[model samples]
Target chain A: MRSLAILDSTLREGEQFIKTFFTLEQRVMIVRLLDRLGVTFIEVPSPVSSPETREAIEAICALNLRSHVVAHVRCVEADVQAALDTGVYGLNLFFGTSNELRSYSHGRKIEQIAHDAVPLIRRIREAGRYVRFSAEDAFRSDLVDLLTVFDAVVDAGVERIGLPDTVGIATPRQVDRLVSLIANRYPNVGIEFHGHNDTGCAIANTISAFEAGADCLDVTVMGIGERNGIASLSGIISQLYIHYPDLLAAYDLTQLVELDQYVADCLNINIPYNMPITAPSAFTHRAGVHTKAVLRNPHAYEILNPTDFGVVRHVDVGSRFTGRYAVGHRAVSLGLQLTSEEIAQLTQALKERAERGSLNDEEVNTFILAWYEEKGSLVWER
Target chain B: MRSLAILDSTLREGEQFIKTFFTLEQRVMIVRLLDRLGVTFIEVPSPVSSPETREAIEAICALNLRSHVVAHVRCVEADVQAALDTGVYGLNLFFGTSNELRSYSHGRKIEQIAHDAVPLIRRIREAGRYVRFSAEDAFRSDLVDLLTVFDAVVDAGVERIGLPDTVGIATPRQVDRLVSLIANRYPNVGIEFHGHNDTGCAIANTISAFEAGADCLDVTVMGIGERNGIASLSGIISQLYIHYPDLLAAYDLTQLVELDQYVADCLNINIPYNMPITAPSAFTHRAGVHTKAVLRNPHAYEILNPTDFGVVRHVDVGSRFTGRYAVGHRAVSLGLQLTSEEIAQLTQALKERAERGSLNDEEVNTFILAWYEEKGSLVWER
Candidate 1:
């Protein structure tokens, strides 16, 4: 009953951001990497954009990856036709519907917009391809309009419906209510959630969507996309793996970090050190008290061992919380041992040094060994 | 009325995650920086932890900072005594009550835990100091229990209550629901939202909490703290300044990027290029189409002008997307001009070079100028 599906939109949405353009070969290489990583779906470019997009899509279709290759298309006949020409495995048709978008940006009435979406869904479905219709800006759209569009698309034979916080404005409560409403009203259709990071809520909204019974999720590698970008693949996958491990069974959890690093390198972006599970600091410890507790029992601070994702727990002594265990461990590494009293004195000395912001490994070891020598309990190896 | 209140816990929660020990002077320096940055409150260390904390808190209090200094204390009698002894401006008392915490960690009855939080709130209130009672695992707590605990605290005269996603698990929907529930129930009380990034929903949760009527937010520079850390100050501030400018009137939006860079350097951590507002790539363009559009109109792809944050747009041409605009701009910058048709030809040649991943600025400019010269369009200056 559980499935792990990775829907990658690097070529379509990721290309939209930054000035780094990908050629047919680079695009093909990105797809190849996703396939090698065993992603469930690779979202290729919109074929309507340019001839280059058409060529990129056709080249990817030729790869015959075990993973499905989907094409992103606007909710218009012309765009859907372009997608069909690319021969993608599925079609992800999207359009805007928020008040600001409907009334100001697109200058279209909600009723007219909903009507426009239905035919596009039908056209894609009639082509015998799986269709996922997205209500762009759903977070800001009126509930009545959202539900009406969802109902229309479902009736039009859309296999899946995606609700996007195009401007990253939806909170988790809204996501819960909306997803729950759709799950209740359209039990036969798959529900997906696509989010932006305009307000940095992409991950939160996506998770809320899942809790409310979303069957699919949209994510970008390293969160590379427009504006603040989309929900990061690592962020969503780690959360699911940690809190809802039973929800996704096919993913190789161990390869998660590797896959993220690979994609980050390909994108030529440095991963944020505080980035959820992949950052170096994610598992490293430096404070004295926390390190002592960790030495006694790692569960004191570590929820999951960093090694689970191929990372190691690093204990640094340069912080204000340097603990006894970290100090003792450093002493051991330096080939020195002393009585508990001597160790206590060394700890106090190290604390003072840390307070002055002048503490270094060499200085710490020198102080520790000196204390041991003064106590007449020193044991030093060559 | 709108207010901008910053709650800084660099010495408390932030110190908890530091791998290196900081001196008392360094602690004071950070507090001074906070005061300089016009932070509303600074959360000092737990006095019960060690002599250094007590001394640092006492010293910081004596400095009489414009920003109020507070002590973080656990929901216990001894901890409260320790905090009171430090003579801080406020107390932040916290405890856990979620199923995961109560059953798996605390091993205490929920009722007993809830009762413990009330007395602590009363104790801080009776002492005539400001108080913020945080539900440590509020995100995962049952709605009934969460509401009951908040009601008890409010009835006991607690002024502010913080709803924390202690393990970084809540989505935006959950954040909005919790904030709305508390705001609606305790109309007069202050509600704060504290989020973690274990699930990468911290920023979104903070914004949702604001929309749901939370009065204050908890953030850290570079999102540094325990585990996946908390919501980033820069990310939240930039989003607010851009989309909800009216919500934070007193905050100096122009100082945001500079402040972020300063914090990163002080912490000795390099800012990630993809970090929301302050990232290098945040305003850099490298693709052909985007560069062309930007050259014609920066607003074509950019939502906000980079100069608003004291940054400028840069167009790099290393990737396959490097188009005619990049080439033409370079040619113009080199004091060379070609006919429109000749520029188109050179653009095509540059695109081919970019696709081959070997385009250099010198070589590209040389090829364009040579073609222009042969066509009698320009003469070489040197």
Candidate 2:
């Protein structure tokens, strides 16, 4: 697990997100953030895409970052030549293999694709750049075609091969089986997983690929890419932290939240509230049962420790569904002392008031204080 | 596979999301949406949580919606009694079986829990309401203790046994094995999966459980829950649509986007950008390679058809990553007549201009037209 590496594609695949247009400077900043997080590779757009993209790749490469700067390029001559000119650390060359892509998108024969990638792979390697060949839509491609292309590319000096769920149709089991078969076939070669989120299994698929012996995985900030995007940087990190914490020791986990925030801001998109580890409410606890359990031990309901990521836990005691335990905990934190019976009574009264309308934080505290004075006196009279 | 059931917990677990405070009217509207979407079960917060929750459950029950209204309740006397009083269709009874939860959260031994749930299960069944016994944090609970509690509840006529990854720590393979083991043990009993997204494996776990013979799955509108949330309703639907399209024919797929939006609005949270079928950009395409393929045939890169969800495909042609094919597609769609060579020149010029700043839709069209007139004449002269 510790040998597994990450390729953060926020600069390359992320540029395909509907709203993303990372200015050259922003691209540089993103690379810096990726380097700080200790990602093994930072994939940028192919220089052939545009003049600024070429400049951005050069600028990022010039930064002398620890992470390898890889450029995503087509196997076409112009794209390969442009990538070589950029003098990046690596080149990720891709060609469509699925029948849908072959017949309609690229119109290339299987033999043509298998033979064409050899020289491009050799060219990148000869230029002192690491090379990876991805059979685009590999999940949907013919097994024979995929194996043929892999045989040619591996024979040519490609260091890694990408298994992309280009259409996001593969199930976790399918991904596991496929990646294991391929990883076993080429044990010495690196296998990378690039999954799309169309079916909402990107994180799971990535995990399956890794568990199946794929050494490299592709991720983007907020999973931002074409359509619904791919596996997310924060998402995979949280998953790895849960399953393989030792593997993430080199990563600056604290920088994840800021990195997610920066990309979301740059793209003018919201950090989705369901985004693991980095959402504004990711560490906030609500609901009576959950809040009560969390009050006793945050571990009762939470697996991800907030403090580990430079955040804190917030138990929302103002909800109508809040428990007496949570309410009482809040009261005690505010320096109020109440018996169990008194706490129950106040909690019931608060829920009744909250039924009509929600109470703010100050109101919850004010009500607790006011009830302590009014309801406490009434209880004594009783 | 159409026999598979969906338990939408947006009203129940979603309430635990820190930002969610669904008003009574909003809760009713959400229930209506779920009913219209044809989910088998609509799980709502237990009445014991708050006075308003009791009223909301009753109000939803009064609608006589086609979907079963299930109340998520603790397997305690007060909670069970409150759930029965609400006259909902079913009760999803749960108790902590894990050591941490047993000692700290609820303080119930395994035997006590095993014994206590039988009576509540019998009583709920006696009240003409369906009952489900969910061993909370079942992933962490001892297998023997789970079997014991589940044996008692199953004997007492519980309709379903929920295998909740309550702490979100189970891997997909772990979930699959556990679900298979339990499903094999209780051949007649129904199995449900309630997973949290803390590890970002909720959707995959649910899929694994479903694959391993679990008939029911727990999901929220936006995967919103205590921590980072759970499997998303849209996510499961999208996955099923891909793997088992016949199972989703009964579903009103078009309502998916609206349901997600309605819930996000109620909670004042943004819909996750990677939310499979509901996010604003879920159907948008921007990558040059992707757009080119999609323009030739949407199926080339898209698994989920936009028309199926009442959304249109948006091809973004303003990015520097725009390919000549994409620009040409845009030109043809805009009724501009240009040869391939002219389109290539215009694409090159567009990329050069977009390098400085991204162009808007109108600007992109204007640039294409200007280049076609200015540079097209030059091409003819050459």
Top of the candidates by DockQ:
2
Clashing pairs in 2: none
Candidate 2 structure quality by residue, lDDT tens digits, B1-382 = 3379999998888877777778888999998999899999999887877666788889999999999999998878998998898868899988999987997688989999978889989898888888889999999999998999988889999988999999888888999899999999999989999998887889999988998889999999989888788999989999888888888878898888889889888867777778888877788877778888888899998888889989888888888888888999888877898888878887888887877767878998888787767865886899
**Candidate 1 chain A TM-score vs. reference chain A:** 0.87
lDDT of 1 at A345: 68
Q: Residue B350 error for model 1, in Å?
A: 4.3
Which consecutive 10 residues in model 2 chain B have the weakest lDDT in total?
B370-379
Query: Evaluated with lDDT, which candidate comes out highest?
Result: 2
Instruction: For residues A305-374, write the lDDT of model 2, one tens digit per residue.
Output: 8888888788887777778998999899889988898899989988878776667678899989988899
